[model samples]
Structures are given as structure tokens and as C-alpha cells.
Target: MNYQPSQNDIVNEYIENLSAEIAPLFLEIRACILEAGPEFNESIKWKNCLVYGTTKNHIQTVVGKGKISLIFHDGVAIEDAYGLLEGDGKKARTVRITSPDFNRAALQDYVRQILQRS
Candidate 1:
């Protein structure tokens, strides 16, 4: 039989190997999502920070040169009363954090809202 690693395992390894500066931000965003509820799961699929729960491919993260991107796969279905979400795609949206001092409370709130929509 062939052996293949699970997505969770891949993501864990990715996180473990992240650069010093990017790792904390990655962790912080992860923690924010996890705190929303116990329904979410994550993995490193498509070489991006992929999250699942409520729906497959529900969320994803991209670590760019100097920014981190939080992507909502079905963002069109969620409420963004604060107008924080960016993107105009038919089905997706994104929020970007450019610095280490990004707002935690707001992020948590956004995560909570997204998770609750599940």
C-alpha cells in the first residue's frame, strides 16, 4: 500500500518550519480561528494555510513578503458589517495584515463571526 501524509500533518510541519518573524503571526491567526469554536480544522493544502470546517476549503491564509492574507472561500455568504473584508470575487474575500502590531481583538471578532456563520 502507498503511504501519504494527512493534510493536518503537512500543515503542522509547515508551521513548525516557518520563519521566526512569520511564525508568530501564523500562530496568532490560527489561535484566533480556533478560539471561535471547536468545529474548525486546518491543514497546509495548495501550499497555503488552509482551514476547514462548516465547509471544505472554508478558509485559507497566504503569507506574502510583508503581509499575511486571510481568505474566506465562501465569503459571499458571510456578513461583513464592518466592511473589513476585501476582494470582489464572486465567491471569496480576503483580509490582509501588514504588520506585527495587527489588531487582535478585531481579528478575533472577525473569526468569531465567520465561524458562527457555519
Candidate 2:
């Protein structure tokens, strides 16, 4: 991933308002995603979700009460060798993160796969 893009202001504001419990986890996840796929552009979608993509939306970050869910829009196509992705939707799958110790390697693999397809 070579086309690195800057973070969006609206997305930054959203991160700023996150609760203490979830903010750190969210930031860790965001950093991992950006590092894995630097070509992705960050943006807010559907009012609350922080979406990352190059030409189209790929991953959507949804902050929940005690966890952060990464929704891969083209998830059905990603090879889940780590068995981290969850969901049975037609296209999307999710990786729910509840702690700071979430598997960074698996997450980066997923991001790289998405980058390749995109």
C-alpha cells in the first residue's frame, strides 16, 4: 500500500468523543489498519461508522458499548486462515475487538488481503 491518505477531521472528532473504555482499543485498531493498508482513506459513513477504503468502502469501524467491530465489506471474499472474521452476511464479515490484546497479526493479514483485492 503506497497511496497513504491523511485522517479525516470528522473521524478524528468521533474518536475524540469515544468513551475511555473503548477509545484506546479503537485507537489501537485504527493504527493497525492504517499501518497494514496505508492506501486506505479514512472517512465517516452512515453518520457514525469510520470507514476505510481506497476507491470504495472496505472496512467499517463500529464502536459498541465495550468493543469495536471491524466490518469488512468484501469479507466473504477474504481468506480467513486465522479464523478471526465473523458474520454470515452475503458480503460483509466482522472482527469484534474487546481488549487491547486483540491479534494484531491476524488483523494486519485481513487488511493486506483487502488491499490486494481493492
Candidate 3:
């Protein structure tokens, strides 16, 4: 697979294709983050999707050329506060995977807490 990404760019055109399968889910996820607080900002970062909190970025999609990666950033660094969210990154402090499966409530809880703490 060949990919050409400009410096500091994460959302390539490839990621836009995921909107068909991931946008609906992404909307739900965004809602969850918004419900957490008013500080979180939903914007396109790295040309991909990103949810920004005041102190730090809360969530950002890692969807790449042929794979998707959703990182929880500092939120996942919290000890077992990810609302029983399941994924390859379950064990790691932060989540790094290429799947659309996510625990909406758990993810919401995570955003809420991180925004509160940060």
C-alpha cells in the first residue's frame, strides 16, 4: 500500500471513505463527547476526525490509508475508566485500533472524566 501524507496531516482522503460506515457511529460518538461538557470541540484534525478538550485532545481517529485507528489520548491513560470499552487497546493505557466498534456510554464517561480532570 502506498500513502502520501503531508507533514502533520492525519486525515487523508482515504479516511473520508470511512464516513459511509463510520460517520453514523462517529456522530454518536461525538454526541457522547459533547454531552460530557461544553469544552470539547469537534473538528477535523489531521484531515481525520478529532474531538478536542480544553487542556488536551480527547479523541482522534487514526484511520489511515487502509486501516483505522481511534486513539483515546489521555482519557485512556486513566485507570480502568473507559466504561468497559472493548478493543485491541483494552489492555494498553491508550487505545490504538482500526475498528468502528466502540462503547458509546463508556466512551462518553471517559470524555466526561478527562474533561473534568484536565
Give all candidates' CA lDDT scores.
0.70, 0.87, 0.52
Across 1-118, the per-residue lDDT of candidate 3 in tens digits comes to 2232322243334334555655455444445556766565445666545645466666676544534444666644555554453345542234433344666666666666666667
- Candidate 2, residue 45: the lDDT equals 92
Instruction: Name the best candidate (by lDDT).
Output: 2
Model 1 misplaced regions, further than 4 Å: 1-7
Cα lDDT, model 2, residue 50: 90
Candidate 1's TM-score reads: 0.78
Candidate number with greatest TM-score: 2
lDDT of 1: 0.70
All-Cα superposition RMSD per candidate? 5.8, 4.0, 7.8
Candidate 2 per-residue lDDT, tens place, 65-112, comes to: 999999999999999999989999899999999999999999999999
lDDT of 1 at 30: 70
Candidate ordering by TM-score (highest first) = 2, 1, 3
Q: Report the error of model 2 at residue 59, Å.
A: 0.3
